[model samples]
Target: MALDETTRQVNKRAVAALEAAVWGLREADVSVIKAVQPLEDLSNVTNAHDPALEELNALTVRIRAAREEVRRRWIAESEGER
Candidate 1:
Protein backbone atom coordinates (compact mmCIF):
# COMPACT_ATOMS: atom_id res chain seq x y z
CA MET A 1 0.00 0.00 0.00
CA ALA A 2 1.04 3.56 -0.67
CA LEU A 3 2.01 5.82 2.21
CA ASP A 4 0.01 8.89 3.10
CA GLU A 5 1.45 12.32 2.40
CA THR A 6 2.66 12.89 5.93
CA THR A 7 4.23 9.45 6.16
CA ARG A 8 5.91 9.89 2.79
CA GLN A 9 7.30 13.26 3.80
CA VAL A 10 8.63 11.88 7.09
CA ASN A 11 10.26 8.99 5.25
CA LYS A 12 11.85 11.39 2.79
CA ARG A 13 13.24 13.56 5.54
CA ALA A 14 14.59 10.49 7.35
CA VAL A 15 16.30 9.30 4.16
CA ALA A 16 17.79 12.72 3.54
CA ALA A 17 19.07 12.95 7.10
CA LEU A 18 20.67 9.50 6.82
CA GLU A 19 22.37 10.50 3.57
CA ALA A 20 23.57 13.77 5.09
CA ALA A 21 25.00 11.94 8.09
CA VAL A 22 26.91 9.58 5.80
CA TRP A 23 28.33 12.45 3.78
CA GLY A 24 29.23 14.39 6.90
CA LEU A 25 31.20 11.39 8.22
CA ARG A 26 33.07 11.10 4.90
CA GLU A 27 33.88 14.82 4.93
CA ALA A 28 35.14 14.55 8.47
CA ASP A 29 37.33 11.59 7.53
CA VAL A 30 38.79 13.47 4.59
CA SER A 31 39.39 16.56 6.68
CA VAL A 32 41.34 14.54 9.22
CA ILE A 33 43.18 12.23 6.84
CA LYS A 34 44.03 14.67 4.02
CA ALA A 35 44.94 17.49 6.40
CA VAL A 36 43.10 19.90 4.13
CA GLN A 37 44.47 23.34 5.02
CA PRO A 38 41.38 25.33 4.04
CA LEU A 39 39.09 23.08 6.01
CA GLU A 40 41.43 23.23 8.96
CA ASP A 41 41.42 27.02 8.77
CA LEU A 42 37.67 26.98 9.40
CA SER A 43 38.21 25.35 12.79
CA ASN A 44 38.65 27.36 15.96
CA VAL A 45 42.04 27.25 17.69
CA THR A 46 40.79 26.99 21.28
CA ASN A 47 41.02 23.26 22.04
CA ALA A 48 37.47 22.48 20.87
CA HIS A 49 38.44 22.90 17.25
CA ASP A 50 37.47 20.82 14.18
CA PRO A 51 34.39 22.14 12.43
CA ALA A 52 34.04 18.92 10.44
CA LEU A 53 33.97 16.93 13.64
CA GLU A 54 31.33 19.22 15.06
CA GLU A 55 29.27 18.88 11.89
CA LEU A 56 29.56 15.11 12.02
CA ASN A 57 28.34 15.09 15.62
CA ALA A 58 25.37 17.29 14.76
CA LEU A 59 24.56 15.16 11.74
CA THR A 60 24.73 12.02 13.86
CA VAL A 61 22.16 13.46 16.24
CA ARG A 62 19.92 14.44 13.34
CA ILE A 63 20.22 11.01 11.78
CA ARG A 64 19.29 9.28 15.01
CA ALA A 65 16.28 11.49 15.57
CA ALA A 66 15.09 11.09 11.99
CA ARG A 67 15.46 7.33 12.09
CA GLU A 68 13.60 7.10 15.38
CA GLU A 69 10.80 9.22 14.01
CA VAL A 70 10.56 7.02 10.93
CA ARG A 71 10.55 3.88 13.02
CA ARG A 72 7.90 5.21 15.41
CA ARG A 73 5.64 6.23 12.56
CA TRP A 74 6.10 2.97 10.76
CA ILE A 75 5.24 1.03 13.88
CA ALA A 76 2.14 3.11 14.42
CA GLU A 77 1.06 2.55 10.84
CA SER A 78 1.64 -1.16 11.09
CA GLU A 79 -0.35 -1.38 14.29
CA GLY A 80 -3.19 0.53 12.71
CA GLU A 81 -3.31 -1.96 9.84
CA ARG A 82 -3.87 -4.87 12.23
Candidate 2:
Protein backbone atom coordinates (compact mmCIF):
# COMPACT_ATOMS: atom_id res chain seq x y z
CA MET A 1 0.00 0.00 0.00
CA ALA A 2 1.09 3.53 -0.71
CA LEU A 3 1.87 5.81 2.19
CA ASP A 4 -0.27 8.84 2.96
CA GLU A 5 1.19 12.32 2.81
CA THR A 6 1.94 12.53 6.51
CA THR A 7 3.66 9.18 6.54
CA ARG A 8 5.68 10.11 3.47
CA GLN A 9 6.75 13.34 5.13
CA VAL A 10 7.79 11.51 8.28
CA ASN A 11 9.86 9.07 6.24
CA LYS A 12 11.55 11.89 4.40
CA ARG A 13 12.40 13.62 7.69
CA ALA A 14 13.77 10.39 9.10
CA VAL A 15 15.96 9.89 6.06
CA ALA A 16 17.22 13.45 6.25
CA ALA A 17 18.06 13.10 9.91
CA LEU A 18 19.92 9.88 9.28
CA GLU A 19 21.89 11.54 6.49
CA ALA A 20 22.73 14.48 8.72
CA ALA A 21 23.90 12.17 11.46
CA VAL A 22 26.17 10.36 9.02
CA TRP A 23 27.56 13.60 7.70
CA GLY A 24 28.13 14.91 11.21
CA LEU A 25 30.04 11.79 12.13
CA ARG A 26 32.23 12.15 9.07
CA GLU A 27 32.96 15.75 9.93
CA ALA A 28 33.70 14.85 13.52
CA ASP A 29 36.11 12.18 12.38
CA VAL A 30 37.92 14.66 10.19
CA SER A 31 38.10 17.17 12.99
CA VAL A 32 39.54 14.59 15.36
CA ILE A 33 42.14 13.57 12.80
CA LYS A 34 43.14 17.15 12.21
CA ALA A 35 43.37 17.83 15.91
CA VAL A 36 45.59 14.81 16.47
CA GLN A 37 47.85 15.20 13.45
CA PRO A 38 49.99 17.81 15.19
CA LEU A 39 50.67 15.53 18.14
CA GLU A 40 51.51 12.47 16.08
CA ASP A 41 55.24 13.04 16.45
CA LEU A 42 55.12 13.55 20.20
CA SER A 43 55.51 10.66 22.61
CA ASN A 44 53.37 12.19 25.34
CA VAL A 45 49.90 13.49 24.48
CA THR A 46 47.38 15.29 26.61
CA ASN A 47 43.67 15.58 26.05
CA ALA A 48 42.63 18.94 24.74
CA HIS A 49 39.15 20.43 24.63
CA ASP A 50 37.85 21.62 21.29
CA PRO A 51 34.74 23.70 20.70
CA ALA A 52 34.21 22.25 17.27
CA LEU A 53 34.14 18.74 18.70
CA GLU A 54 31.65 19.79 21.32
CA GLU A 55 29.40 21.38 18.75
CA LEU A 56 29.56 18.34 16.51
CA ASN A 57 28.73 16.07 19.40
CA ALA A 58 25.72 18.16 20.25
CA LEU A 59 24.58 18.19 16.63
CA THR A 60 24.90 14.42 16.40
CA VAL A 61 22.82 13.97 19.51
CA ARG A 62 20.12 16.26 18.16
CA ILE A 63 20.07 14.49 14.81
CA ARG A 64 19.69 11.10 16.48
CA ALA A 65 16.89 12.44 18.63
CA ALA A 66 15.10 13.78 15.57
CA ARG A 67 15.46 10.44 13.83
CA GLU A 68 14.09 8.63 16.85
CA GLU A 69 11.13 11.00 17.02
CA VAL A 70 10.29 10.33 13.40
CA ARG A 71 10.50 6.60 13.92
CA ARG A 72 8.27 6.81 16.96
CA ARG A 73 5.68 8.85 15.13
CA TRP A 74 5.70 6.57 12.11
CA ILE A 75 5.31 3.48 14.26
CA ALA A 76 2.49 5.05 16.24
CA GLU A 77 0.66 6.06 13.07
CA SER A 78 1.08 2.63 11.54
CA GLU A 79 -0.23 0.99 14.65
CA GLY A 80 -3.22 3.29 14.71
CA GLU A 81 -4.10 2.37 11.14
CA ARG A 82 -4.55 -1.27 12.06
Candidate 3:
Protein backbone atom coordinates (compact mmCIF):
# COMPACT_ATOMS: atom_id res chain seq x y z
CA MET A 1 0.00 0.00 0.00
CA ALA A 2 1.04 3.55 -0.78
CA LEU A 3 1.16 5.21 2.58
CA ASP A 4 0.93 8.96 2.97
CA GLU A 5 3.79 10.90 4.55
CA THR A 6 2.21 10.91 8.00
CA THR A 7 1.39 7.20 7.79
CA ARG A 8 4.89 6.46 6.60
CA GLN A 9 6.27 8.23 9.62
CA VAL A 10 3.94 6.38 11.95
CA ASN A 11 4.84 3.09 10.33
CA LYS A 12 8.52 3.88 10.71
CA ARG A 13 8.06 4.61 14.38
CA ALA A 14 6.03 1.47 14.94
CA VAL A 15 8.61 -0.69 13.21
CA ALA A 16 11.42 0.94 15.15
CA ALA A 17 9.61 0.39 18.43
CA LEU A 18 8.93 -3.23 17.53
CA GLU A 19 12.56 -3.86 16.57
CA ALA A 20 13.76 -2.22 19.73
CA ALA A 21 11.41 -4.42 21.69
CA VAL A 22 12.75 -7.57 20.00
CA TRP A 23 16.35 -6.57 20.51
CA GLY A 24 15.56 -5.71 24.08
CA LEU A 25 14.03 -9.13 24.53
CA ARG A 26 17.15 -10.79 23.11
CA GLU A 27 19.34 -8.66 25.33
CA ALA A 28 17.01 -9.21 28.27
CA ASP A 29 16.26 -5.52 28.67
CA VAL A 30 13.36 -5.61 31.09
CA SER A 31 12.61 -1.92 30.69
CA VAL A 32 12.24 -2.18 26.92
CA ILE A 33 9.92 -5.14 27.28
CA LYS A 34 7.76 -3.21 29.71
CA ALA A 35 7.78 -0.19 27.43
CA VAL A 36 6.50 -2.19 24.48
CA GLN A 37 3.96 -4.15 26.50
CA PRO A 38 1.06 -1.94 25.46
CA LEU A 39 1.96 -2.37 21.80
CA GLU A 40 1.06 -6.02 21.71
CA ASP A 41 -0.29 -6.08 18.19
CA LEU A 42 3.03 -6.02 16.41
CA SER A 43 1.54 -6.59 12.97
CA ASN A 44 0.39 -3.00 13.11
CA VAL A 45 4.07 -2.15 13.00
CA THR A 46 5.49 -1.81 9.49
CA ASN A 47 8.94 -1.29 7.98
CA ALA A 48 8.87 -0.17 4.38
CA HIS A 49 12.62 0.32 4.37
CA ASP A 50 13.07 -3.39 5.07
CA PRO A 51 14.14 -5.31 1.97
CA ALA A 52 11.56 -8.02 2.62
CA LEU A 53 8.47 -8.78 4.67
CA GLU A 54 9.27 -9.60 8.30
CA GLU A 55 7.79 -12.69 9.88
CA LEU A 56 8.49 -11.28 13.31
CA ASN A 57 5.95 -8.53 12.76
CA ALA A 58 3.09 -10.94 12.18
CA LEU A 59 4.40 -13.51 14.64
CA THR A 60 4.50 -11.10 17.53
CA VAL A 61 0.94 -9.97 16.95
CA ARG A 62 -0.35 -13.50 16.66
CA ILE A 63 1.61 -14.67 19.66
CA ARG A 64 0.46 -11.80 21.81
CA ALA A 65 -3.17 -12.38 20.93
CA ALA A 66 -2.91 -16.08 21.50
CA ARG A 67 -1.07 -15.61 24.76
CA GLU A 68 -3.75 -13.36 26.11
CA GLU A 69 -6.50 -15.74 25.13
CA VAL A 70 -4.69 -18.71 26.56
CA ARG A 71 -4.06 -16.93 29.82
CA ARG A 72 -7.69 -15.99 30.10
CA ARG A 73 -8.80 -19.55 29.43
CA TRP A 74 -6.33 -20.97 31.89
CA ILE A 75 -7.53 -18.63 34.58
CA ALA A 76 -11.14 -19.48 33.86
CA GLU A 77 -10.45 -23.19 33.91
CA SER A 78 -8.55 -22.93 37.15
CA GLU A 79 -11.32 -20.93 38.73
CA GLY A 80 -13.86 -23.51 37.61
CA GLU A 81 -11.80 -26.29 39.13
CA ARG A 82 -11.66 -24.48 42.44
Whose TM-score is greatest here? 2
What is each predicted model's overall lDDT from 0 to 1?
0.57, 0.58, 0.49
Which residue runs of candidate 1 sit more than 4 Å off their true CA positions? Answer: 1-49
Which pairs of residues have clashing backbones in candidate 1?
none
Across 1-82, the per-residue lDDT of candidate 1 in tens digits comes to 3568788676666656656655665565555445545445556555355766566556556656665655555555545541
The TM-score, computed over Cα atoms with residue i paired to residue i, of candidate 2 is 0.46
Q: Model 1 reaches what TM-score against the true structure?
A: 0.40
**lDDT (Cα, tens digit) per residue for candidate 3, span 1-82:** 5567776676566556555554544444344354455354442575452322243445556656655555554454434431
Please say which candidate is ahead in lDDT: 1 or 3: 1
Clashes of 2: 0
TM-score-superior candidate, 2 or 3: 2
What is the TM-score of each predicted model, taking all chains together? 0.40, 0.46, 0.36
- Over 1-82, each residue of candidate 2 has an lDDT whose tens digit, in order, gives 3568777777677667656665665666566566545544332344354444555556657656665665665565545542
Identify the leading candidate in terms of lDDT: 2
Runs in model 2 with CA error above 4 Å?
A: 1-3, 44-82
Candidate 1's error at 46, in angstroms? 12
* Ranking 1 against 2 by TM-score, winner: 2
Greater TM-score among 1 and 3 belongs to 1
Superposed Cα RMSD, model 2: 6.9
